[model samples]
Target: MDYIGHIKLVNGQVPSESLLLDEANIAASRRVDLHVQTHDDPVLKLCLWDQAASEFWKKFRASGGTARVVLVTTLNPKRYGVLSLSSMTPSRVFLDGDIQETRDYLGWLSLNQDVANRLNADVVVKPEPATLGELFSYMKRASAKVAWFECTAAIDNVVHGSKWYYIGCGDCHPKATKGPTTLLCRKCGKSEVVGVAQYLAKLSVYDHNDQAFFVLLGDAGEELTGKKAAELVESYYEANDGVGDDDIVPVPQVLIDTIGQTRTFIVKISTHNLDGKTQTLTVTKVLPLEAPAPKVKSGDEVDVELCNEREDLADESVKRAADGVGSEDAKRARCG
Candidate 1:
């Protein structure tokens, strides 16, 4: 057995109402014995027997004395009150709560196995109905053997190899909502679709911090001839003596279907100094093509009928290609 020392109650040691006064006195009296007789190593085993147990343990641990402190208290509501008040210190506080009822504390300790194993002192707890289940769940997972003295029948569920006794509750659980309304979970990457509108609203707000905005539209006729359209817009701007910069305004939304496919964009051009007014310009011509065609030999005159038929074939080919189904075999096998 790991020397179970009891801080029993005694009379006249201090004021009658002072909780843990007897335990404190016993601890004080045994300080010298613990230093000199405990193999000169100064490790005295101390336990609590009073309401002031939490305070006494905190002071004893903080005093840098020669004793190793252990708290053995029932997991009653009163014990929880005391432990919760003194919980900020690093020392272990145990509860004599029912092992089955105090499973949550056990679960916490079991989850933090490495920290629990290295603890130098005992922290006891009194288990409630909820705690018993939590503790059993925890014990099922813990790898170390938790030893205890004065085992009671109420907590027979604690097996031989259990390590964590209940300490106390740290915090309460948060409330649940009717449904998830957020797009992303900060904890996980899960996404929800219902909050898309809210997310977009948040993004559009001035303080939203997102700067980029884009509109993806179906293919536009103007887009097919981007270079030609751009040059045409530039010439129009120059001819109109609009603002000097080459800032082309986007085409009106209504014209997107007509101009997008032609690679031609429409923009409204205006200058702030010019009465804050703007005019739309359609840029339809691009840089002139160089070497428009290959010269044919004068003697190698192609037949007129052949030339006309070739032009018709070429136009038909272009139409078929635009329809997204142009095969060489189909063209060869068909007559326009």
Candidate 2:
């Protein structure tokens, strides 16, 4: 069967052909694993060898890792525990074409940040506690040192600047060109791709004295929405059945329900100016109000001084009342 899809990755250095006969074929085969996501739903892995391998490897290296190609090749579907596809003779390939499927896949690749995140999952430790006001103030201060801040505040409202979800390029996952036959990623300058659904939830949250805009991206957005953007998009299509791809997916009710709710979050504040000012907050983690936090010891100097000051004032007030009562009693005895 002719398998046509995007080349998501091109691995390095082909091993000798003899490695193909050994069990090491799993590791050798000098195989190039092409992560291909279809325009509709499923993402598949395709392996290339021989001429196909040499051509793809050459172009991939030439493009500085941004090269995308569509392959129309006969594939051997093998089931070594899992179903896999490998290139066979009589295969063909296309690069950066005007084909609609190629265009759709490219669009998807450019905006597929979730796909990128899954491909590159690295743990980021949550930051220290702060207020929304403090987060903004930190960004403004010339000597600000912290990179991330943990904050608790009431979500004043969910800002509907446009739609809650955005159609982004699968490759770089940035917002893509709309109303065009092919998706275009401005950053990568690639076209003919599909759009991936991702959350772009902007929230207005505030403490007692101040309010700031906080953005929840990808998993953080999914956490706030209580469902993945892909899941929500799929559900919308299942319900609407024949809706056009250009039609917008409605905001999930779960996301809507977050309004006026209080949640603790770890956010990274942007220090550099964007658009005009530098104070921007991005939520990295959504935690429950009762989430475990480090205990502040009562013996800390600040706490100790506050306790001492309250106790001293209490003692002085009691002594003044006692003296007033004794003087009144002495005056009453003198009068008698």
Candidate 3:
């Protein structure tokens, strides 16, 4: 379906706001939230992600930012506290004369420019900074829906035993399960899929007196560790030449090195947290260490030094091949 509307705003172009979502390799993965006003939908926000986002901005710049009417194709309709349209990989953005609909809409917009002018473009939702306690509290509320928040927390522990990375369908990146012969992706409903390792690392994070689990999904791990999950997995396999397919790689030292560091994370919350299926926060982005961390609210500061239990839990499963902990014998031990 094509969404034709008057483009009210495109994020990252707003002045005095360094609102660049520093979540991904940015250049390759940019996000543009479109404040569009259309017939029947007054405050529709179209989220252009990855390719769609970068290209839209390119065309917007080429047009001297005068392109008012936008025509976006293949948007996935969603409601997350607000009605929103999110673009997928196949989505494309068109503006002004680029498409017949946009051209016609632009002509119509020129006649009723005041209608577009009446819309408040500043209604876009920006991620608010929240503490772990506050985030979980929101989960219990009946009104909680999909939302993003920035949380500054100290790395208390790197979770152990959980699979650090799962073999994902190479095309879509969904986790693939072991099939009769090859890995299968249920989401794609296919067999013999292309399998590639992707990050699914876990960390125990704490802010003030609130502690919560944060799962680094997709490229979030790579952004924090400064190394690709595939590279780390390949290095491990090369070192241990013939490890069994069933044998899982232990948490890499690169991730462990972040144990005591403090970083601000952009976490996304949804029904997964609200329904109590899991309270684990899915980390979408990590702010650079040099950037000032969000201030922990007064009377809620947690002293990690005094939390000896967290340190102990992190070191319990240190990647120790010398002790045969990560060896074939260790793998068998875990099953037993």
Best by lDDT: 3
**Evaluated with TM-score, which candidate comes out highest?**
3
Q: Which run of 10 residues does model 3 get worst, by summed lDDT? A: 307-316
lDDT by residue (255-333, candidate 1, tens digit) is: 2322211111211111210221111111111112133344565788643322100111112222222222211111011
lDDT of 3: 0.69
Reference-based TM-score of each model: 0.13, 0.45, 0.55
Residue-wise C-alpha lDDT for candidate 2, range 184-284, written one tens digit per residue: 76656776667787666666677898886666665677666567777788788999978897776765767766776778887764433222243446666
Candidate number with the higher lDDT (1 or 2)? 2
The lDDT per prediction is: 0.24, 0.56, 0.69
Off by over 4 Å in 3: 1-125, 291-336
* Winner of 1 and 3 under TM-score: 3
Ranking by TM-score: 3, 2, 1
Report the lDDT tens digits of candidate 3 across residue range 9-114.
7652331233333334445557777778785356677888889888787787677666677888899987554567889899888888997888888888788867
